[model samples]
Target: MSRSARAIAVNAALVLAAGLTLLPLAWMVSVSLMPTGEASRLPLRLLPSAPTLEHYRTLFTRLDVAGYAANSALLATAVTAISLVLNSMAGYAFAKLPFRGRDALFRTLLAALVIPAQVGMLPLFLMLKGMGLINTYAGVVIPGLASIFGIFLVRQYAQSIPDSLLDAARIDGAGELRIYRSFVLPACTPILTTLALFTFMGTWNDFLWPLIVLSDQDRFTLPVALANLLGEHAQDVELMMAGSVLTVAPMVVLFLALQRYYVAGVVSGSVKG
Candidate 1:
């Protein structure tokens, strides 16, 4: 094939793939805007006969989706902020700070990642229950305050920081905390932003743990509340679609907004490695 023809072929394939990938999301938006009972009609329609916001209104007023959204936003934000600090400190220490058995300890932690998270869920629940954290935001947020993947990402990025810079800072009589605050944090901003976005999206989308921990309806996150809505409003397809849009829209917007940082972090880490 001619180079021009090959390029045209590749572009056509990409366009086709992109359209297929986005079809469901487009359908979702269409269905969400559909009038009540329109989505369940005999013929599957891509576009609503007449768009309406009744489903959205129903979600906010009747289904209390706004409250659930607020809960998700609060929990996800808190988890992201706290985890960034803890994970960054641990990752940077592993990368730069010297200590007895530090390599071995880090290796052990990496090995622990092979274990399924579900394996500890029961014990975690029992421990939280003992501490009276069940049915609370703390319970949902505690387990996610640090993750193995977050540490790994940060450590990879932190390894790129120059040891000479840290040594110079120390020679200048900078304390460990001062060095971290002044130099390390700024250097790690791209990776930290990536990690923060990851944490926020993961926490926002989490359903099983929140459902298990938070028995009260008032404390349900968007995902958990959406599941509950399915149980009570199974026939309300339009309303369900609206709720799904609300549940997913924030992460979409957030990723779009901060994707540059995320991409930069991944590329930097790959180059550093």
Candidate 2:
């Protein structure tokens, strides 16, 4: 093939792939506005014969998706906030602080990363149940409070900070917490934003743990609620699509906003490793 032909072919392939990937998402939105039974008709139509938001209304009013949305928001926010604090503390300590067995301890944790979190999930669930948090938001929040990967991400980024800066702070009588809050936090803003985005999205999209722990319908996160909605409203294609859209929209927006930082973190970590 000629060079231009090859380039044209590559561009065409990329456009095809993008369309393929977006097809389902596009269909979801289209069907969300479709009349109740139109999506499941004899022919697969790309659009509603007559578009409407009635299904969205049903989700918010009768189906009580608003509650599920609130639960999802609360859980995602809580997990992100808690993980930020814990991960930053552990990460900063690992990077800058001199302590007994620091390298060994971090090494142990690095090894622990090889262990699937699922391995400990059984015991963790039992522990949470014993504490009466099984059906509560706290149950969902506990396991994600500190992710090994989150800590490692922050640590790798923190290591880039000059030792002289920390030493200067120490000599100037700045306490560890002060240094962390004022200096480290500012310096780590990019990664912190990235991690917050990661944690929030993970928590929002989580299905298994939330499915296992939360038994109450009132406390169900959006994903769990959507699953439940699927059970009763298999016939309501428009409503299901609206629920899917709501469930996906926030995380997508967040990712687009912080994608640069997230991608940068990935590239930096790969190079460092």
User: lDDT values of the candidates?
Assistant: 0.91, 0.90
> What TM-score fits each model?
0.94, 0.96
Reference-based lDDT, residue 144, model 1: 92
Question: Clash totals for all models, in order?
Answer: 0, 0
* lDDT for each residue of candidate 2 in 176-226, tens digit (9 for 90 to 100): 899999899999999998888888888999999999999999999999999
Sequence-dependent TM-score of model 2: 0.96
Q: Which candidate is the best by TM-score?
A: 2
Give a tens-digit lDDT track for model 1, residues 1-273: 999999999999999999999998988899999999998898888899999999999889887888999999999999999999999999999999989999999889888987988899999999999999999999999999898778888888899999999999999999999999999999998889889888898899888899899999999999999999899898988989999999999989998999897677667546733
**lDDT of residue 200 for candidate 1:** 90
